[model samples]
Target: MYLSYEETKDIAYYMCDRTQRLTLPMLVNLLLDVSEKQSDSLERGEAYIRDRGLNWIILHYAFDIGRMPRLNERVYIETFATEYNKLFTYRTFIVRDSNRTELIKVETTFALLDSKKRKMARIPEDIVAPYKAEYSKRIRRNKKPDEVNSEEYNEKQYAVRYFDIDGNNHVNNSHYINWILDSLDSTFLLDHDITRGVITFNKEVSENQLVFSQSSIREEEGLNSDHIIKTEDTVHCSATFTWDKVKRRNMNGYDQ
Candidate 1:
């Protein structure tokens, strides 16, 4: 079964850049919100799973942008439970304009966490049943982010701010997008728009911790970066990012 929601990207929030369209982080945040809402409606949401002493966290995410909507433009986002394994829940999304043209499509993998035990856990059948999940794969399976262990890679450090933490006391995925994008040069950020991104979460980071976000221009592959959230020996979390040439819209932009 599929569930959906609709909203217009707020202009107020985009005063800087992407003022006419949803920024990468904003788009990601919206996707996560829609996913959570669908799970809640299916009785497999955060609170529901938390009650059972288990929770779900995104393990991998990949999305392709076709056309980004501009300010005040209405969008319809629909989400579906594609599949699940003993350890991961698979889901997908379709984002379109009011006229019904697809703007973006995304596939994500989420893993069950034993919140109390603080380790990995198998998903319970009850929750899986509610999503009507299957075993089929939709998009390409997410790969471990490519490594950029070269001396040429540029590194930037960030301080974990109070607002960056989510209810789970860990950094929100949207903020990770922010940090990853920030590693780029201002000229690159303004000139080339991101067409695709694949990120994987490795661990968790808490408040006040320092993180190192490293980037290397895969001039051949846009920008690639790895994020490390830590200050000590323990690596809280890391992510990989890949950017591509942006694709703009046409007269029949919503047709896709």
Candidate 2:
């Protein structure tokens, strides 16, 4: 089901810091929260599948940061299931602010997991039924394949720190975004605000693994530019992020 007007406002409000500009990590966390809530709602009145843990294993995620808006501005947003393949489920997001038409668009893939073994498992019938009912038209059957274009982007280096790994014992998906964002020059970051991003993870970076972060920029037709990231020998991930030279809201109080 789509979020109600008040529900959407509440989510949009929480998406930003006190200054009201949302960060990449904040948007990622918000997506996770909403997915978990939907999962819980589907599993209600049924025996919790202890083997299939509630947390989703993020295979890949992409965000299109559309525009930057001021704090206290009314923004409307919604997220819905888009597809379910043999092993992964896809979801999409759209956001818009008061003065503009569209602010952001995002799509992500997730897998139901056996948390302890770190393996894929089937989603329980009851749990999957509600989502299918609500989003059958949006669900596509195509499965995502693992592939990367290693020759296109230039490679850079990164030293993976201890904090990069999450409870699942591998590099957290959000950390990939951090590495990509860090690869951009500090001056660029300070001068412009990120308006959109599209990222896909090809492989996981484990603890202490020296990672090669690669990127390339292209002048696109729109107001934003295109970007990609890869490892030295392997293309770990690729993404496109757009930026606008606008007054950015201070988000120092927000969690990174």
Candidate 3:
């Protein structure tokens, strides 16, 4: 059986940027809410046992945006679990227009965390059995993002306001998206839209902690770069973003 969920999004805030299209952080928020409906997630059956006090943490995620939906555009997202292993479970999502035209695709890996112990937990079989585990994956699994050197990066700092923290007492993954993308100057962000990205979350940053967002340019592959988010000494997260003027594809793989 394929456990599925659906939602529609309308861009009503500055969240989309001057490009007038949905931003990556908004897309991430959409998927995160959608993820709760899965049988394997903390919000759903069997997995929802509260006394056990378990939650899910994203280890890594990647998405490909073939087209960015415009402001006031209502886009539909359909998501389902692809499969799961001992420690990691994979899910895929597709974004479509009202007429069913495909607009975007995303895949992510999640790990179960025992809240009390603060450690990774193995996924139970009952959780994996319900998904459409056909050994299919839309995108290849991504490794942890590289840690950038402190001296060789452009950086910005942000305060962890109350709203930025989630129930986990840390900056919500959705807000981290904004901090990373926002570090890029407007001229570059306006000229190029995100075609794909990979983010790996390492440590956790709690409320009142100062966040340092760091980035570096890689001009070789269309427009690509790496980013890191940390405090004064310890790292919290890292990611890589690849942008293009527009989607470029070949029969074998992505052209850019």
lDDT of residue 248 for candidate 3: 49
Query: Each model's TM-score?
Result: 0.83, 0.66, 0.83
Tens digits of per-residue lDDT, candidate 1, 25-116, equal 78878888887887777767788888888877887887777766676777888788777777887788888888889989888888888887
C-alpha lDDT of residue 228 in model 2: 43
Model 1 misplaced stretches (Cα beyond 4 Å): 1-19, 136-141, 221-256
What lDDT does model 1 reach? Answer: 0.70
lDDT of 2 by residue, 202-245 (tens): 66666677876655444554334334444456666666666676
What's every prediction's RMSD, in angstroms? 4.7, 5.9, 6.1
Clashes of each: 2, 3, 0
Number of the top lDDT candidate: 3
TM-score of 2: 0.66
Cα deviation of 226, candidate 1, in Å:
5.9
lDDT of each: 0.70, 0.59, 0.75
